[model samples]
Target: MTAEIVRTIPGAQKRTNDPEGMRKKVLDVAEASFQEKGYHGSSLGDLMAAAGVSGGALHHHFPTKKALGLAVIDERVAEAVAKTWIGPVLAAASARDGVRLVFEAAADELEKQGFVRGCPLNNLAHELSLADPDFRAALARIFRAWREAIAEKVRADQQNGGEKGIDPERFAALVIATYSGAMSMAKTAQEATVLRQCLAALPVSGQPAA
Candidate 1:
């Protein structure tokens, strides 16, 4: 329904102020906070206050900060990939259309979210790729799968009788690289316009980059 390519769709407002509910609330709040402030910037006290939960309760959900960070990345990446990149791309008219659709949807999601959270994979890539190799590997797998899916669709289109010039394999890689790079730049500038401009410029049909 909304652009959530990079960020979680802000959950329903913390409804019940009960204890068990509050712990879940803390996790939700911490998730959003981590996305907003990064792992280092999010303080336990701050997260607790936002959650309206006590320190003991917060710790129950996550005993350590690193544990919580990994959970956040794992869950967020799965949800984000399904929503912003994978499903819709697979639903397009063809492989080329699939690639175009994903970019268009990504751009739309970023702008609709006001580009606040930006892309989670891109966010993680910038920080964790060097700081945490395991996290980086996990995220890299997601990107690779995404590119492969797009490439597969493109190959299918070619076999089924589609347009010309574009090498689906190469083009899929470019789309992934371009979109990721564009999102990173847009987030840094706090403007979706830059990424939107790049998306607008991608030809729906083009020769795969040699």
Candidate 2:
């Protein structure tokens, strides 16, 4: 089932008997479990229990754990990147400000949530990159897409003579790497200060007044 289908169904929890509902519920719970605990650390039994679905139900939909993980990556995780990063960056008035705003909003969220967990993509990348090629490829695609989104904005900024000094590709790579590292540090320390410090150090020039 598509993430769009999962999202459109109201009262999903109350419709467990329906095939689509069961599938959506399983994906929802599995994504949360995988995010909280590493993929290998999260077992099918735990997922079934958390999702309030029987083993038969889960098997009927996913058939195997790997299939479920891939679905979460392709659907939920991809959708998250689109909603949180790509869409906002595309819509903002200035690409540089768009990138900064994303980090600033992330810092605020980290502070509000007490910085318990790091970025979902970063967490999965660390855990699964060496374990499975499929997982690694899926994650790499997301990372490339994210970097390209930012790079496109940087290129636009450069063309407009806003961010003229740096190479757009290099700058985009730096932004993603720095943000990921800062999130890891924040997760380790259980503090948001690391993110704020990183954001503060970001280069900005010719930025229009907000």
C-alpha RMSD values across all candidates: 9.9, 6.8
Residue-by-residue lDDT tens digits, candidate 1, 90-112: 78887656667777666677777
TM-score for each prediction? Answer: 0.76, 0.86
Model 1 vs. true fold: TM: 0.76
Clashes of each: 1, 0
Best-performing candidate as measured by TM-score: 2
Number of the predicted model whose lDDT against the real structure is largest: 2
Model 2 / residue 24 / CA error / Å: 1.1
Residue-by-residue lDDT tens digits, candidate 2, 1-210: 554545555654455457567788898998888888878999999998888889998998898888998899989888888898889887887776777888888988877877468888888888888988999999999999999998888888777777667787898888889889998888889898887677777774343322
Inter-residue clash pairs, candidate 2: none
Name model 1 segments beyond 4 Å from true: 1-24, 109-115, 163-165, 205-210
- Give the Cα-based TM-score of candidate 2 against the true structure: 0.86
Task: Give candidate 2 misplaced runs (Cα > 4 Å).
Answer: 1-20, 205-210
